[model samples]
Target: MGLPGTIPPAQGPARPALAVVDVQPHLQQPATDRGPGRLHLSAEGASRAAGGSGGGEAVKVILLRDVPTLGRAGTLVEVKEGYARNYLLPRGLAREATAGAIRARDVMRQAEEQRRARVQREAEQLAQGLSALILEMRARAGAEGRLFGAVTAQQVADALRQRGFPVDKKQVELEHPIRVEGFHRVAVRLPTGRLVQVTVNVVGQR
Candidate 1:
């Protein structure tokens, strides 16, 4: 009835290796959406939205505190309407959608602005003090003005200490170790949002 090795007809449906389906309407969630979020009130009166709380007919704003990465003052973030009502607003982390909350938010913003200005003023004062910083070096150099190797942070720190101004090596911010002989301005980090600039004058050895 058949030639050698001829196969018979198949009967049942083929098995599925894998199944892929569209996401159900309930499960179709967005990773990030812009909507209402929780508005956190600051002691200084600035309002920012804390993480997670947000929503409603009125736009929600979540107020966050002075997180290091997020800067000095609190910040507001908008989130979705539904999420704000069901989760964020009820948790006391954020206030309701109203005119009173908005007015309070403006006050909070003004307070934060004043604080920033004060910090900036202090930073300028620190910079001015650093003008007197002069670093001397003891290196073996030739007529062309190139050093034997390169000047490093350890060298700079040691020299600063001998001059009576004890500076920490870690506070120095250099793009690269000083190799060429020239005058350069190096930044020194200080406390309370302050920064100091030190002058480096590399001269040839006699």
Candidate 2:
């Protein structure tokens, strides 16, 4: 006798498959590098960390300057093999992302950071000196309180320089020229948004 219902189709057990992925790390390069050859750094094993072991599809390069539509200097980037060999390498705009080159870049970056910090410290010291010192400016004036001419930022900066302070003309935050001869309060601007209030003693030239 035949079964009452149609025979059921065969069923099988389901199994899961595993997928894997690989990742790589890159390091910094120097912006001031104008030469094309790879740099060999003395930093211990830093070069090894910057090394890339991948093959074929693309080539890695460290940028020497800011490239339009690309990236800024000191960055490690990958580009098409032909593009790197034909353009970037030839123009000295970048160097091969060699282990040694990356190491050297890191060293240069550290030195640059140290130099900047030193400059910041010096600027702060100068700001302190400017705050305690008085800047005297002489101007020709008539009988009235108003002076014949106005005092400019250049004059203020020069006064500070004469007092042994390295100050730029732009550092003097004088909104307008001083028209009268008297005591004036001026703000001296410093790097990192620091401001120092300074006293200006303007005297009318006899």
Candidate 3:
């Protein structure tokens, strides 16, 4: 009630951002658990992810990339129809995991697998050579053989590169910089998570 004359404002509950599940004509699938964070889903399994009638209108989708709680790339998972139609589909993060879509991706999946295997083989071969390596480095030292400056991973990596090995400083798993001169066994980590030990011989110079 206003003193003179005032129109009363209309009152209504605020709508939730993702409340309405606007189901479209989008027909979509089950996800297979590949190892830990991956999956290879079948057509039928993917469709099951999208509920038929009982699941409150869920939609199955194959993720193009990892979604926080949903699934990883290539994994088919169920989501709200609204989420699929509005967010995931438009953002290019996922696609409808239809039976045909699942079958169509088989060739691409195989090629990716082959590429991964080849990379693994290359990493393993390099790791073997690094394991048998004895790398020597010279640095200025005191009477007690303590280095004036610590030997770093960058220096080690540079030395390895000079010897014709493609090494990155990041791959040198040095727990700490070497302060004292001696034979220190350093681990060179590979892309496949394998650690190869390479002996680093630090000699004192004037």
Clash counts for the predictions, in order: 22, 0, 6
Q: What's model 3's lDDT at 104?
A: 67
Instruction: Say which prediction, candidate 1 or candidate 2, comes out ahead on TM-score.
Output: 2
Q: lDDT per model, in order?
A: 0.59, 0.74, 0.78
**What would the per-residue lDDT of candidate 3 be over residues 1-206, giving only the tens digit for each residue?**
75668778788999768777755333232245344333233345334434444335777888888755566688878877865676567768788998988876676798999999998989988887888888999999999999999999999999999988888999998989999999999988888888889999999997
Residues 1-206, candidate 2, lDDT per residue (tens digit)? 44788787567977667877664333236457545443323233222233324333577899997654446787888766655675566767688999999999899899989999998999788877887877888999888767899898889989888888878898889999998999999888887578998899889975
Top model by lDDT, which number?
Answer: 3
Error (Å) of candidate 2 at residue 198 is 3.0
Badly placed stretches (over 4 Å) of model 3 are 1-49, 52-62, 66-71, 75-93, 96-104
- Misplaced by over 4 Å in model 2 are 1-55, 68-70, 140-143, 170-175, 187-197
Alpha-carbon shift of residue 101 in model 3 (angstroms): 4.8
Q: Give one digit per residue, the lDDT tens place, for model 1 in 1-206.
A: 56789986777999878988843212123236523332333322222222323323435554433322223333454545564465445644445535676677778889878998877776566566566766766667777888877888877767766766546687677768887788878877755545677998887674
RMSD of each: 13.7, 10.7, 12.6
lDDT winner, 2 or 3:
3
